[model samples]
Target: MTNKPTALPARPHFSSGPCAKRPGWTPQQLATESLGRSHRSKLGKARLQHAITLTREILGVPDTHRIAIVPASDTGAYEMAMWTMLGARPVTALAWESFGEGWVTDAVKQLKLNPTVITAPYGELPDLAAIDFGHDVLFTANGTTSGVRVPDYDWVPEAREGLTFADATSAVFAQPVDWAKCDVLTYSWQKVLGGEGGHGMLILGPRAVERLESYTSAWPLPKIFRLVAKGKLTEGVFAGETINTPSMLAVEDYIDALEWAQSIGGLTALMARADANAAALDAWVRRTPWVEHLAKNAASRSNTSVCLVLPGLAEDKVKAIVSLLEKEKAAYDIGAYRDAPPGLRIWCGATVDTADVLALTGWLDWAYAQVTAA
Candidate 1:
């Protein structure tokens, strides 16, 4: 193995969630104009609306879609959609990782919906052909834990009778989502945009709106989950009228991130940046002897959260390597998800620099050698 590299990544923030901030980001970079002001004020609401508009623009969302800043992060957005729109049809919940499994738990235990659950082990995709699209389908677009992603939307039947609810928290902005196949899509700013947490963005297409207008759940709907009132969709919710108070600071932070996205040429540029970061690691993984990508298939490998499986290494040894890396200040929060098979999880989202990812591979090699030599 090579000697410990003298050079370190210029930036080492690689946590999958609450990912590294946009390039050149600093706390002072955020706009303070919206702080200390009522969220209901014209300026504050405009800020929220601007975030909504910029998000749509960057995402290339359809004109027919309704975008809302919802309560909580991506989970809240998913729950809101499930609570509001399921039971209209038979349900299908697909799982290949922890987050996908969480949706299954909600479907079977909490919502009490007798949905068909199709799943696979870590680092593999479930049989997409076996899915019953005649029923409501809920799944995560990217498996952040397993380093697996549903390759594309080609598997979703075009003539299906159900709506597709995609939890794209880790995929949006970094991956191109086939909006034509997705009806209800949700993401949080903390993922790709590198913004503050506590806010979720929910986008509804025509079919989703149709379900909201036509279907009503038998369960009790909390005020926060209520998207309809007096027999009509709450238009104001999509227009930046939030159900509860929101942190204006988080709002402004998201706007700043969105502005950064725009400055870097929007979604296309963002995907390229993330792809470059992942490619840097991929090039290294190709030559690495002791470790490999957790994702077994190249087609399903995620570009945003690149999980790696140490082929012959013990999980404890992997943890020790991670601890060593952290102690050396070479990386931080790079451990695999607790629920996932033990390995390494690196953030290759757009906010992370490609140079840093390249530098990280060298440290991984050094750390691996150091651990094994002991």
Candidate 2:
């Protein structure tokens, strides 16, 4: 009953992080960017400003919310928020996967903050219903490693006591975030959008700003992590001014990506694209009994980084199938995260075409058959 797939995917770049670039992207597209110039110069400033403006317009962030492009990737943005803001209140760190667990470690081990740690194993969600919103909450919007995402913000009470920080590096653009319930959200350009890495974007709602001005961490703050001075928020950081030197080339590539986002509609369209891409693969998974989604709850499953668990296959068999697919140039970097349970992790973000996803499934089946028959 096994037959090789007749057609190949038109595009096969699908790494979850630094995911596939916008269709037809090449080095030639960056020809007009400011090169070897100071980011503070007028032309560079305008380019950076354009990126910030389009981001705000497309994402529909609140008027009071502030967006900043900072050094390092999403990790820097998240760590900045944690170092500057977490000690303000008793914190609640939630973890169902690796990135979430990283934040928990930062809270308890690094900052030495006494906080409540709530956790769940892979393939299951933490008890979102039981979290005490009275304390400052920290959670990832999507678990890139395990492929679980919070279905919605309805679980959080409206008039809760403390701020909510969301590490949404993999969630933005692919999933709709209810920012009304969120205080601090952080992401990098390299995720949903196929932009260059090396920078992070931090979006701060009104309450998040207020916390920055009002609270000070007991631990020593590094220069890069400092977000306040003279007991007031550094407002300049939000207005295209960065805390450190940023890659002008990366800045331009991001601008191009943002413009591409605009041309295709806005966040609504981007999310729809990701959903459709995920659906294509999901349909195939439903018919394939050997594999199932890593996220046990259907509602909690991620549409972007779709993780799948092989029911009874050994790790070596899964790795061999991954190697076969890679050797055939049918898929790249679809292996599950190293720490996560043995499985396949596919990127179905907006940048990924549904046709490619549909094509990839055949390759998966072919690889599985090749491994099983041997």
Candidate 3:
């Protein structure tokens, strides 16, 4: 029998979304000046604008692109882009996981765009060469549920007739995004940044803005989804004036996270942290006999949501392992996504320390032994 590990991860917050907060983060670390003020107030607008500026700086988003704070986290931002800009062109939706499938449903059922759907099962990727760039393409940069990610943007053409809408909620900060290839990109504060939820960031390249000015959706857009007014893009929204009231507290928390990123040597450093954490977990997975990565290709594996499967284990047995880990408080929220294959999903984002991931491996071994022995 394997012995229970003595050391516990200092912070056992391995949830993929609302992920572990930055190292040394606390409520007191957030600024309170914007807390009670109106979002339209001078102080509030400046803070919101500051968050956008820091995002562009840290992400190295070119000046040609516009960034804005939107409502309802990543889902909201992604749907907003789809509702506003998709009907004008032929659509191609890619799915390799639950979230990607959700977008496919939206394109087929809700928008009635009758898009060409391309899919790969969990732990795999759709053929990149098969996609037609002549149509608007929608894909998640990282399969948050399946632990799969596109290796890079080299497959995308430099010039295309259609827009590339990248739902990059989990990829932003941890992965290098080729901004030129993505016309519409959306992410939320709650992902890699580990900030509070309920807010999203929408980034638009020059092409996306041109589409907004030229094309109008056939269906009626909700007040929150409207990006253009009087046939011109709403410039103020990109400049920190949001379409709806925002949670200033959340905005402050996001700013705090961005500033933390800047202090840690910017985007390169954040990517390095995530890479190191994932590498540590990968090392363990490689040596372990009972577990294997859900993602078969190392190049397509996600560094943020690193999923592992116990081959031949029944689903109930997998659940038992998850319950055991949580009961012991050795790990939290590391279970596989409900829709994903039965397995374990450990978040290895920039906020997570490699030591915590390593320590959790010992607990995983102990938990596996306990569960299997029964």
The model with the greatest lDDT is 3
> Any residue pairs clashing in model 2, and if so which?
none
Query: What tens-digit string does per-residue lDDT give for candidate 3 at 1-374?
Result: 89989999999889999899999999998999988999999999999999999999999999999999999999999999999999999999999999999999999999999999999999999999999999999999999999999999998899899999999999999999999999999999999999999998999999999999999999999999999999999999999999999999899899999999999999999999999999999999989999999999999999999989999989899899889989998889999999999999999999999999999999999999988999
Question: Candidate 3, TM-score vs. the true structure?
Answer: 0.99
lDDT of 2 by residue, 1-374 (tens): 57889888888877888899988788788746578888888887788888999999888888889999987899999999998988777899999999999999999999988899999998778999878988999999999999999999898788988999999999998888787888999999999998999999999999989988888888898788888999998887888878888998899899888888889998999999999999999999999999999997889999999999998899999999988888888999889998899999999999899999999999999899999889
Q: How would you order the candidates by TM-score, starting with the best?
A: 3, 1, 2
Candidate 1 residues lying further than 4 Å off, grouped into runs, are none
Model 3 C-alpha lDDT versus the unseen true structure: 0.96
Regions of model 2 farther than 4 Å from truth: none
Which ranges in model 3 have alpha carbons more than 4 Å from their true place? Answer: none
Best by TM-score: 3
Instruction: Return the lDDT, model 1, position 27.
Output: 84
Which one wins by lDDT: 1 or 3? 3
TM-score per model over all chains: 0.99, 0.98, 0.99
lDDT of each: 0.92, 0.90, 0.96
Q: Which ten residues in a row have the lowest lDDT in candidate 3?
A: 322-331
